[model samples]
Target: MIEPQPTRRRPAADVQHAVERMRELARALPARDGIAVFNRVYLTVTEEVVRRSADGLFRDPLASAELSARFAERYLSAVEVAAGGHRPPACWRPLFQLRRHPGVRPLQFALAGINAHIGHDLALSVVDTCTARGCEPAEVEGDFERVGQVLTALEERIREDLMPGPDLLDIADPLTHLLGAWSLERARDAAWAAARVLWRLRDLPEVYGEFIEGVDSSVGMVGRCLLTPLG
Candidate 1:
């Protein structure tokens, strides 16, 4: 006779608990504080992406040292902006120079995609709440649509920038393993960091309701997509 097998643990229970906690947090937030909270969260996520990319890109001894230095400076400036301030000395100019470097282009494209997604989310959330509250719906819709268009354009630009040429596969082969692992880790951390920042916005009364409602609605939509029975 065979010995009884140990039962397998279900991870879904943990996920469900996390989701429930998120819903509770969403419900606890007040209405007016959403936009600021979202902006801060979005900025935090973007800054993390930039920081990780900078670190990874600079680790290449063969890469442009000046470019890395400029990127670090720009990243710091962006961090300042994220901290409720302006970019020092126009850091975006130096940051844009990364696009010119073949080695740095892939990371730039990835960061652009991440920023576009964040902007799209923020714009749509604003539009959703404005419409829900019967406040300047048409203007908000137009702005939201424009933001979506901009996001689409940025996505296309990034795709074109990142398209590998004939020699790219060979050049990338050496660093592929390391870059892949780092990018995945960074993306995961960025997403969670963003979520935590948004969660903290629950304390700010002015943006709290909108943030909670927007997040709750987003979560609900995701849940519906996941929980719907296969047709």
Candidate 2:
């Protein structure tokens, strides 16, 4: 029989607290575990953001921190839902579902998590940040871009470090083709576009709600494909 999953409360409002939560989760799981792999990547990004924020690197520090926290909360919330034995958002479905699949490589786990977060959660977080701060998306766009830059850098390193060795580069290699089909740059662009659309649709709650659902489902579909286990 399946065990019941616990639903944890959302992370605290403080960015530091969120960082700690991520750190704790990363530490609690095995280093090579799929979810732990992604958590470690995210934890690195969060630490960098915290460091940059402390150095006053962001134009809107408050917005940046709030955005970061809200964004992390979404990911955590999805984990909580899954832990509670409930379904998470479509975008998150892949990671939680395949997290323990031995055939699913760590790189796949990391990339799929990044895909789900940036493709779906980031856009919503942008709008959430705007609503909480009573400001426009444009105002927090810099913070969003900054975080994207960090993710982009880490993504490059992830590919370099986790990608299978040169022997796997054959034209028929499914990993190559699968990884090639998804680009961080393209996903980031789509996320930014979606964020703008969501902000514009803010006044139309019904329309906005529907749009969110569409984005989540579409991104989730891509994530599911990305997590397809390679025999």
| Per-model TM-score on C-alpha atoms | 0.26, 0.89
Model 2 alpha-carbon miss at residue 131, Å = 0.9
- How well does candidate 1 match the true structure in TM-score terms? 0.26
Mark the regions of model 1 whose C-alpha exceeds 4 Å error after superposition: 1-78, 81-105, 116-134, 164-231
Ten-residue stretch with the least lDDT total in model 1: 61-70
lDDT tens digits by residue: candidate 1, 125-150: 33334433445434333333333343
**Cα lDDT listed for each candidate:** 0.35, 0.84
Clashing pairs in 2: 5-83, 5-84
Report each candidate's C-alpha RMSD, comma-separated, in the order given: 22.7, 6.4
Q: lDDT per residue, candidate 2, 1-231, as tens digits? A: 999988733322477888888888877888877778888888888888788778877888878888888888898888789889999998998888888898888778888999999999989988988887799888887777877777777777777677768445678878888888999999989999999999999999999999999999999999899888986
lDDT (Cα, 0-100) at 4 in candidate 1:
100
Against the hidden true structure, what lDDT does model 2 obtain? 0.84
